[model samples]
Target chain A: MTFSLARPSTIVEALRLLADDTEGPTAPLAGGTDLLLDLDDGRSTARRLVSLDKLPWKTLAWDGPRLNVGATLPLARLGSDATVRARLPGLSEGVDAVGSLALRHRATLGGNLGRAAPASDLLPILLAVDATVRLVGTAGRRELPVARFLRGSRQVDLAKDELIESVSIPEARLSTYVWQRVRPANDVSQVGVAVARSGSSASWRLALGGVLPVPTRIPEAEVHLTEERPRPEDVELAANAAATHARFVTDKRASEAYRRRLVATLVRRAVARAQIPPGER
Target chain B: MTSEVALTVNGAAPRRLAVPDSERLLDTLRWRLGLKGTKEGCRTGDCGACTVLVDGETTLSCLTLTHEVQDRAVTTVEGIAEDPEGRRVLAAFAAEDALQCGYCTPGFVVSLTGIRKELGASAPDSAVIEALQGNLCRCTGYLAIVRAVARIGNGNP
Candidate 1:
């Protein structure tokens, strides 16, 4: 509640402000929906905030099949984009599942991935779609797979002077995000499942969320999805493998046993949802 | 780190004032400007009680930093009547008697007004209802609120 805010219009100034520790650790403020709550409640120890609002990172670009989203673009803007909705349905589903319309209006993809909360609804889809995170710092700009960029909850592969520049999805996929929660909006998922398939390859990519540490892919389950449309038996096998594979979280909000059951059910539903024909869906 | 900030509110001339760096827009509206119409139910973004429009987009004032919206147009429930769409939404809520405790009414009305701006007046009733998922109404069980949304969707509110 007693931190100085720095709104640098350029990336260099923002990095310099973040690197200057004389004022104490500066947390980058993307949308501030989660960070503000953490700072106000003493959960975060940041003594300074570098607002990304002024930076020219609120961009969304599509080059052919690849889509690049600037780190500060709001989740609402991403979800409302017609091409994003059409090409990456699962990503849209994940964006919509984050919070209410008001909250989504301010939440950003960079903030979501930077926080890397275990129960984040966005990560599963990001992993399913094989998104890549681009970062810039004293070491210069580097790109890493989202699977490698995330270290742990409240942890990322970002240095003190580093900033997330953009996230790139290599190509669009047939994908969907499915989860169960007490409430549809602003509630953490008990178990989140995302399934995606490349246009060229019928092989499905699967990821499980609401797990401890980080959301991860389940290659063991994906093998069961052999055809464009998987059979009921293979889907059941895939779901069972998914449930058995994920490291479900043991938070007070959900029982570990219940989470396992939800994972299996959600995995089945997500696979079915992802494999639906485009026009039929 | 107090700084001089300037922003427009309620269709008025830009108000320039000194504000603390960590001040939230919700606090600035309630305490600094005395615009108590924007209630603070949850300091977090879960409750939409602090909903307002920043540059014509629905925003959660609780999660938004005052400095983040510098020089932007802000419209609160106090200024809801200034816009024709907002006025219609407010009148519809009153006609439907959409509130009991009334604590959540302002947020619902503001959110509906924002929906009108985003989706236009002819947006479907289902879409408007889905958009209200952010708002919580302990009293009236959302029956009256649904009626209000229905009235707006009918383009008669």
Candidate 2:
């Protein structure tokens, strides 16, 4: 509650502020939805906050095959942007499922991935889409796969002076996302699944979240489903394989057994949804 | 440390004040500026009672630091009273008896106003529902609120 805030106008200045030792450890603030809560609840002991609001990282650009989403791009845009909705419907669906409309207006992609919460809606979809994250620091820029960027719950593979710049997702085909929660809507997912395909059924990518300590891709299940275009029986087998790969723990929102079951069900549904023709969907 | 930050509120002239770095915009509006219309039901971002507009975008004031809004335009419920669309939405809410306890009304009104601005004249029923997801009404069961928004969007009194 008692922290000094530094609003740096440029990325370099922001990185400098984060590296400064005189003010104690500084946490980067992007769309303060989660950071402010942590600051309010005494969960964060950061004595200083480096605001990324002024940085010129609010753009969403498509260069050839890669779509670059700035870390600070608000989640609201993800739902409403025509280009994003057209090309990355799975990511759009995941972003839309986050909190509420007002919260979406303020929540940013960086904050969503930076917090690395187990139930984050974006992480599973990003993993399924094979997104790459870009980070900048005094050491210059580095890119890492989304799965590797996340270290653990409430942790990221970011250094004290580093800031996430953007995430790049390659173009893919026949992708969709689905989730199941205890609440009807506007609640964190008990189990979420995203499936993306590049060409054939064998090229399918699958990721699951909320049933594990981290959002993760299930290559074992994906390989099983890719052997053939998923039939009802194939879906059931793939779902069971996904459930086997998932590690769930009982939380206040759901039981371990229930979440594991949800993992199977949502995975099946997500893949089936992904296989539907665009015209029908 | 406290610093002087200047920003426009409700289309007013820019106002400057020395605010603490940790001060949230919700506190600044309610306590410092005496704009009590922006309610603070939950200090966390879970509730939409503290919703406001920063640079014409719906934002949760409880999570927005006062300093972060420096030199930007902020719109609270009090500032939008004269806006034609805002007035129409409020009138529709009144006609539908959309509220009971009324603590969450200001937030709903502000959020709906933002939705109207974003969607313009053709706001769909589903978009309105999505927009209202952030707001929670403990008293009215939300049916009246949805009906009010639908009526306003449909050009019906």
Best by DockQ: 1
Predicted complex 2: CAPRI docking category: medium
Worst lDDT window (10 residues) for model 2 chain A?
A: A196-205
Clashing pairs in 1: none
Q: What is the TM-score of chain B alone in each candidate?
A: 0.96, 0.95
Local accuracy by lDDT, each model:
0.87, 0.85
Runs in model 1 with CA error above 4 Å?
A200-202, A277-280
Fraction of true contacts reproduced, model 2?
0.80
lDDT of 1 by residue, B27-73 (tens): 99999999999989878888788999988888999999899889899
TM-score against truth, every candidate: 0.98, 0.96
Instruction: List, residue by residue over A93-182, the lDDT tens digit for candidate 2.
Output: 788789887888879998898988888889988988889999999999999999899887777899988999999987664778898877
Candidate 1 chain B: worst-modelled 10 consecutive residues by lDDT: B132-141
Error of 1 at A56 (Å): 1.0
TM-score of chain A of 1: 0.96
Q: What is the C-alpha lDDT profile of model 1 across A243-280, one tens digit per residue?
A: 88878778877988899888889988987888674446
The list of candidate 2 runs beyond 4 A from truth reads A199-202, A277-280
Task: Choose the strongest candidate by lDDT.
Answer: 1
True contacts kept of each: 0.86, 0.80
Error of 2 at A22 (Å): 1.9
